[model samples]
Structure formats: C-alpha cells, structure tokens
Target: MRAPALSALDIHLFQEGTHSRLHDKLGAHALPAGGVRFAVWAPNAAQVRVIGDWNFWAEGDAMTPRTDGSGIWEADCPQAAPGQAYKYRIVTPSGELLEKADPFAFQSELAPATASRIWAGTHTWADDAWMRARATRNALDAPMAIYEVHAGSWQRENGEFLGYRELAHRLAHYVKDLGFTHVELMPVTEHPFYGSWGYQTTGYFAPTARYGNPEDLMYFVDHLHQQGIGVILDWVPSHFPTDPHGLARFDGTHLYEHADPRQGFHPEWNSAIFNYGRHEVRSFLLSSALYWLDRFHIDGLRVDAVASMLYLDYARGPGQWIPNAHGGRENLEAVHFLQALNRAVYREQPGAFTVAEESTAWPRVSRPTEMGGLGFGMKWNMGWMHDTLRYLREAPVHRRWHHHQLTFSLVYAFTENFVLPLSHDEVVHGKGSLIHKMAGDAWQQFANLRALFGFMWAHPGKKLLFMGGEFGQRREWTHDGELEWWVTGLPGHRGLQQLMRRLNRVLTEEPALHAFDFGPEGFEWIEADDAERSVFAFLRKGPPGTAPILAVSNFTPVPRENHRVGVPLAGAWQELINTDAGEFDGAGWGNLGGARTVPVPSHGRAHSLVLTLPPLSTIYLKGPTRATNA
Candidate 1:
C-alpha cells in the first residue's frame, strides 16, 4: 500500500489546531499515477473501507491506518474514477458500521441523494484584471452596494433552476446594469434541505450540485469577477445540522461537535453547534473557509449568526448553557476561533475581507484583534435597520414623535465600519416587502420607500439591498419562487428600478458619499432638530478638493417651499437626485434644476440654500466644488 497521504508535519499542525490547508491533504484526490487516493479522519474507527460505484460497494479494499497515530485512514484505489459516488464504511470498536459522506468532498450529489462524488476542479479563470485590482475595490472607503441574492430563486426557467453558468451571465448583466459593486450570494454550499437555503451545510467544500458541478460554480464567480463585480458568500460556521451522513457522530463519537448537549446543540436553530475548542474541528473549518477564497476567488464572506456564536447564553435559559473559564457568558473558544479566522483570512487573502452579521452590541466586532476586537472587516447595522423600518411603518401624522429613530444611527455610525443592510430577513416570515412596510397609500408607500432609499444611500455607511427590492416587489421574499421580474412593466415599479440605478450611479460617482463613510469629518447635520416638521437635512463631505453633497428628507406629506439648509461653500448646487421627481413617479416638486446659496444665515452657516422639499421625499444636491469643476 502507498504511504499515508498526510506527512509528519501535517499530523503536528492538525493536532496543534493550526493547520489551515488540510483540504490539500485530506479527502479523495486524483493521483497522477492512476486512480484516486482517499483519506479521512476517524480515530475511533476500528477499520475503515472505501465503498463506491467503482468497487461495487464492497469491503475488500480496507484502508491503512497511519503509523504516526494520526487516526487518518488512507487507501489507493486504482479502480476508482472521477464522477463515481463514494462513501466511507467505518467499523467502530463496538462492531457498529456507519456509512458516512466524505466531510471534505469537493462535490456532492444533489439533495435527496447522499453520495460524495470523486471530482477535481479544472476551471481556467479569466478574471485577472478584477483579481489584481480587487484590493482597492474592496476597501472600506470604496463604494460597496451589494445586491443580496438567492441563486435558485433569483430566476428560474419554466419553474426549473438555472445552472450556475446560466445564472452567472444573467446575474452579472443585471448587477452591472444596476451598478452594484458586489453580489452577495446567500450560501451555495451543499445542503440536504433545499428550503434551508444552504445554511445547514453538509459539504463545506462542495458547491451545491443542485445548481451545477464545482467547475460550473467556479465559472459563476469567474464571470462575475470578469464583469468587475465582487462576490461575497454568506457562510455559516456557527452551527451545522445533525444529518446521519454529516459531521455528527463520526467514528461513533462526537468528533466535530461537543458530546454535551448544553454546549453542542443550538436550541433556536435545532442544529449541532461546532465544538470550537476541538483542534481538528478548527482545522476543518479554517480549511473550508480558505478553500472558497483560494479556489473560487470569493471577494468576501459574511459570517452569519455571529451573535449566536459569540455568547454562551444565546437563545438559552438559565442552567441550559455553560460558562467560560472566567465564569462569563461569552463563548471564549468561539471568540478565539473567529479572531483566528479573520486573521488568517486577511493574511492569506489580502484583497478579500469578512463581514459579521452580529445583531448584538458586541463591542469592537469589526475592529482589529490586536486592539482587543473580533478583527472583522465590517458588521451589519441591525440597529439602524430595525429603527428605520420601525419608524417608517408609522403614519405620517405620527412621524414627528418617532423622528429620533432616523437620527439615532449617526450617534454610532462609525463604530465598526458598518453596512446598512435592508436584507432578506426583513421581508420574510410575514414581515412583508420593503414597499409594504411604509405607512401610506399606494403612491405614498412608493414615495416613502424612495425617500428611505435616498436617505440610506446618503447615510454614512456601506449599503446592501436584497433581491426584489430594486423593483419594489409587493410580496414577501420566498426561497421557492423567483422575483417578480414582470413588475418592471408597471410605471411605479419601473420608476423605482430606475431610481435604484440612478442612486447606485450617484453613490459610485461621488467620492463624498463613500470615501469618508467611516469618518465623522465626512458628515454634519444641518437640520437634525426639525422633528416638529418631520424634516431632516445633513451634509456629506469628501476630501479637500472634492465637492460636498447635501441631502434633505421630508417625512411628512406636506411640501415645504423655501426650506433653508446651511451650505459650507458658496456655489450652484445641482439637484443630483429627487425621489419625488416625475421620473420616479412622485409629486415632481423640487428646486428647478439647481439652487444658488445666498448670504442668508441658517443652521449656523454663513450661506444657505432655500430649497423646495417635496412631500414624502428625499433629495440630494451636489455643490460645484473643485472636483466637480475639474
């Protein structure tokens, strides 16, 4: 028999919990000599055998255990060929036999089937330009408007799912047209349940075969990168489902998760939580994370359910959870794992970054590890999303009393390099669509949504809008159905789509909007105290030579003529965007093209512009500064 696949150094690192590239050594690999070399980690197994279509599912070819005591079983099967589905038949010490799918399999059979396929990636990438310059494009200061999408539901042909290659061209064209900088895919990793939306991951290394094979998914990312759109995958390292063929009870033991239910199980998700304290499990997760970035060239990863991972008492009542060594509620092991994960990601994939979907007010979530932080690149602004949505649901007559919701986010806008996400979570489980959340009639609802978007874009943070939102889909998001693509035929919906395109263009074109998003100097309030009138105004500033942008919002239904807003510079301010303009299906009440600041004092500024504030709308005006002139 050939020597074991793992070397002495691999054994040391895997045991030490620092091996980041275990994928290259473990799993089934096509040997250059002939056939495939299979390896798996099952220390408690008395014997392990490779069973597959090539071997007639027989137990004749028993795997050899490593002499180094690594508990890894290896077998060189010259008869095993690519595309053959296989599983490890492990015999436990108590004579119990368990057939398990390869944990490190790069490709798996589609849902309703539980076989791992023998495959190797052979995709030739054609995204050199995007890969080379992605560092600057993915920076915190860059304009990043992500269009969150579910691959299967985004679009389907004749009620059938489109392959990854097909979704690639169509999605890239649509996202490019809308001017979104990135497309954040809701997990495409292999899962047994289609309705789980890839969250209950069974094969971390495999792209779901329901869409396409490994190379086809690779083409998906490559094509999007070629079109200058970064890809961010929603990754769930927090917990995994306890399917019989999955990571649960491997080798007749809780190898990947804790044996104690209090520490291992997630009551809310009804899944098994990863035992972050385990050395080999850490290597498995870290390797899984790097595999996507290395093989698929993913631009970033949005770590889902981070708050659940951070707290031991999360979703648990007293005595149902365990405390850390310091007797605190924090999951110390998970904290170390997250910090290590982020450090490894940044060090290995310099251009790529990570975001945390942490709902709690966990301090320094996006800060660096050395600064006593979690070391994530960004965190979702759940507070802002919840507050803004709650305030928008109120009637216009009652908006004045809840005006603080609109202004409260700025108090901590720069806390963790936030991303203002109006995500799919808000539109599911009877929450209704974003348009329906507004407080008004048909026209006013549309107007309120438009104003909310305008204010969001002008706000100091990165932006993310889920699918169906660009065109104002009237129903809640369903993973089983496609977006209402036909709604673009309607005047209001089409106008909303047009507004999204225009807003994205303005966000990307203007440095003042994105360049200083995390800096307080880039923003200032001009009329934050106008709760009685339910009006708000603010200024967004860029670098020295760049032009400044003024954004004003009227939450009420009454239009205000000659609403004086302070201006820092004396110049002709052009109306860059008015959500109420006739083009956006609004009242069409706005300043006639531009407004020139006068010597009149207002809002503590020497010069002020008397502007027309349309009802239930927000407008952005660009000052003619040196950058605009140049």
Candidate 2:
C-alpha cells in the first residue's frame, strides 16, 4: 500500500495526518437535504485543495491535514449540496500542482460539460430485498450468460441517440429472450468522440451524454435488475485518452496528469495516464469505483484495458513510451489504483465485483488485495478466447491446430476467476462477424458458431457473447448502424439467436456450466484429447449432486458413432442439451441416452462414461439419471 520510490519530482508535494484533516475540517462531508457525505484517504500529502469549473479552477485552502497522523489530506466540502462542478488541487512540499477528480464525487462533469448538477442518487430499490439475499460471488447461481454490448452502437434512430431508458426496454427484450443472465455495457462515462469506443475516456464521473444523462443509466440498470438480469458497466480508470475537450487539459493544463511527459502520456493509446503516485489521484479513482457500486447498484465493473493500466509501456511496440519515475517498466500508480479501487468497492459493497479485461500474465487479478494482487473478482480469459478462436478458424480441416491449441485452457482456466469473452471488438473493424469467422458459407457458419458456443458452455468459465453473434450477424459491427435486425429473414441468423437463448437458459439449469466462475473447485478436465478423431471431451462441476454435466464436442465433420468419452463414475448421465438438436438447425447429431455405464480408456486407467456424443455438435450430459431418453 506504500507509494513507489518517489523521484525528486514525485515528492513535490508532501503532507501528514491521514484521517482527521479532511473529516473534521469539512464537517465530515455531511450531505445536506439528503445528499452524500464525501471523504478521501490521501496518506501522503502536506496540503490538499478542491478545484473545479464551478469554483473556476481556483485551488481552495480547504484541504486540511488528517488527524490520524498518517499524512492523509481531509476535505468534506459542502459543495455537492446542489450538485456543482469540482476537482482537486494539492500542493506538495516542492510546489508542484496536481489536479485530480473529486475523490468522493458521485458524478464527474466532462470538460465540454464542465458544469455538473449532482443530485443525491436516492431511490427506492425495492430489490434491496433481493440484493440482501443475493448469493455472494456466485457466478454459477447468478445466471451470467452476459451479452457484451457497446451502448452507442447497440441502437440509434433518426439522428437522435437512444437514451438509457429506451435501451432498457429494447435491450431487455433482446437479452431476456436471448436467454442471457446479464447485459454488460461498455464504458458509458463522458468521453470525447465516438471512435475510441469509450476506452479512451476522460471524464470518470459523468455518464456519456452521447447516450443520455446519469438518471437514464440508473433507470436502465434498474429496469434490467427488475427483469432479473444483472447489469455490468465497463469502467476505465487504467488510463484516460488525451482529448483537449475532456479531462486531458482541464483548467488550462494537463493538471490531472503527471507534469512530466514520461509519466503522463500513453503512446500506444495516445492518452494521458493518471498519476496514481499522487494520493489525491488515488482517492479520486477509488471514489469513482465506489460511486458506481453505491449509486447505480451495478452488479460489477468490467474494467477495460487492465494490461495497459498495469504496464508502463504495454503495446508500445518499440519506442512508443517512457519509463516510470521508479526506473521500472510497470505503471505502479495504476497497480495501486486498481488495488485501492478493489478495496474500497469490496469494503463498500461486499458482493460487488471488479472484473478486469486484462490480456497479460500479471498474476492475482482475483487474489485478495492484502496479498499484493490487483484484487479483481475476475479477469477476462483473453488467452483462452484468442487461442480457441484461432484454432477454430485455422483448422478448417480440423487437423491444422496442435492438440495444445484445442486443450490449452486447462493450463490456466483455473488460474484465476475468468470470464470467456467473445467481445464486440472481435466482430468489427474487419474482424468480421462471429459467424463469418467460420470457414464455411452461411449455414455452415451458423453451425460453426453453434459448435463454438457448445464448446464455450462446456469450457470452465463464465460466458459472454457479443450482441450480434447471437443472431448470426454476417458482417462486422458498425457504430453508426443497427445490428442487422433485418437479417432475421435469414434462417442461419434466427437459428443462431435461438441457440443462444436455449444455451443461456440451459446454462442456468446446469450448475456445471458456470461453477468455475470464481474458484477452482467448479471445473475439472474429464478428457483432454480424442485427437485420433479430432474431438475433445470435458466435464463441468457445479455444486455436488448438482455437479457433473459432461460436455462432449466433436470438432470434425466425420461422424463418430459410439463416441465413448470417459466421464466421472459419479452415476448415470443424461443427454440434457444438444447443439445440433434441429432446434438449432444442426444435423441432429445426438441420440437419446440414459446413464448407462460404459468403460472408456484414457491417459491412465479405464475411465467410465454413460454418454453418447455426436459429431460437430455439443451436448450437455447430466450426471447419472435413472430416467431414459424419451
């Protein structure tokens, strides 16, 4: 929890007293007329000040020292009573100027929309009853077949943007009927331009006006929650893009960023990174993390680009970035910010999750904060998706990919809490639609997707399918366009959507599908290779008795009769769901099988299974059932 070795430049400002300074001086930041009481923890500053547009960028001497003798700055300003604009300006011993976002402000107004109106986000969450009884960290019991969507492109009409409320009803039906347990929207915060896809966000507090206002987002989340669907927002605190009209140069300078370019800009993203080195910045970012969890009742944060946040020069290629002040290649400020964000969010909302979309080997994303980890509840399994998809696309003949490509996830599937994301990025910018990624024509494309999804369900992780992938979008996604809803005329598309819904519902019923959501106990590899026939078989474990749903997939076109993959000797397995069940317009590759024990050879001993797997399809075979196939 200590700051990195401060450079002569980093310690430009230093102060003392961790708790009392801001609390006592700012009246404990008590909210007047039903407002929020704000407080920040900055254990390394001599003096702290509040600044913002409403205050006209004037640094107030209001930042007093904390009484805890921990060097934390204290300020409980009453400025948010009517929801005015604000920021932070602190002076270090060396007289450097640092401007950071309000550590506890519920909303941040972007530079273009600097003047903010902060109303208390007080509402009657009748679902509070549900929230209280909600299972903690139970991605399995929680029904999490999330639909990854970018709000801006999800829908639009007549040059008028679709507000949050509009999206709630529309997307609700789409996702609900699609059988997804949740809807995950990309970052909605106020950002510049529609190009960055909200990744290069500048305003940490404001809801992006491109969609609608703050309440609109809250209403959207509320509606989704009411529909028994969880809402997860993509949050970006790892870095902020350099947009002159946004936070990059607010108050006539890059005050929110580091003064030196070495510690300021991210060359790969062309953005300005935060100085996590500053205590005020830490408070600002942590408070933003708490704001979403507290006010919006958001189930989780799908933290974007964590790799960029954790590394100083990630994706920098050759000479695109500068070294940190500590002579290390990593952005330590970002590391601490993520840690603090997790700590604050967990402390404030125990079950609230912080998920990172990180693609690196930075360990412990799901580890406890006290253990020198990033403290995320889950991290996206990017390696799994990339390698799996590549294997799918390159192996048109099913023999090109090595056995490792098909079964490599077992090496790290249980490494941390992971969610398998077939994100929007994969379907756009010439990447082609998820269906188009298949090697065949339209029908085969849909079948390939069906096969892929069957594999996804069988894999040991929570699932996320992009918006259009469900309905068989053939072309890449476009922001200015609607998801070819017109394509419903095509059978390939309809079948895909139907399969998605069926899979989602079935996933909920079968615990084995998502039991590996958090811990290692949920998943086990039943069979890694059937390489002789280009097929793979695995088992998913949920809560016991509820455990053991055999996932059998045939990657090749040549049908294999009596495809006897060894399943656990737990009991008789039932053919629960088949991807090729004609319902999805597949070849109907499954045969009605009851739990009839059959011995099969494997890596070591004779493994036994009571299931029949068909070619180029997926079947969720539930454990030992006395019932026979109808």
Which is the leading candidate under lDDT? Answer: 1
Candidate 2's C-alpha runs over 4 A off are 1-122, 135-142, 249-254, 317-327, 398-400, 517-521, 570-572, 593-595, 599-613, 625-630
* Candidate 1, pairs of clashing residues: none
Q: Across residues 37-107, which tens digit of lDDT does each residue of candidate 1 receive? A: 99999999999999999989876468988877778989898999889999999998899999999999999
Candidate 1's C-alpha runs over 4 A off are: 626-630
| Residue 506 Cα positional deviation in candidate 2, in Å, after optimal superposition | 1.9
Whole-model lDDT, model 2: 0.67
Model 1 residue 438 CA deviation (Å) reads: 0.8
> What is residue 509's positional error in candidate 1, in angstroms?
0.4
TM-score computed on alpha carbons, candidate 1:
0.98
RMSD of each: 1.6, 6.7
> What's the TM-score of every candidate structure?
0.98, 0.81
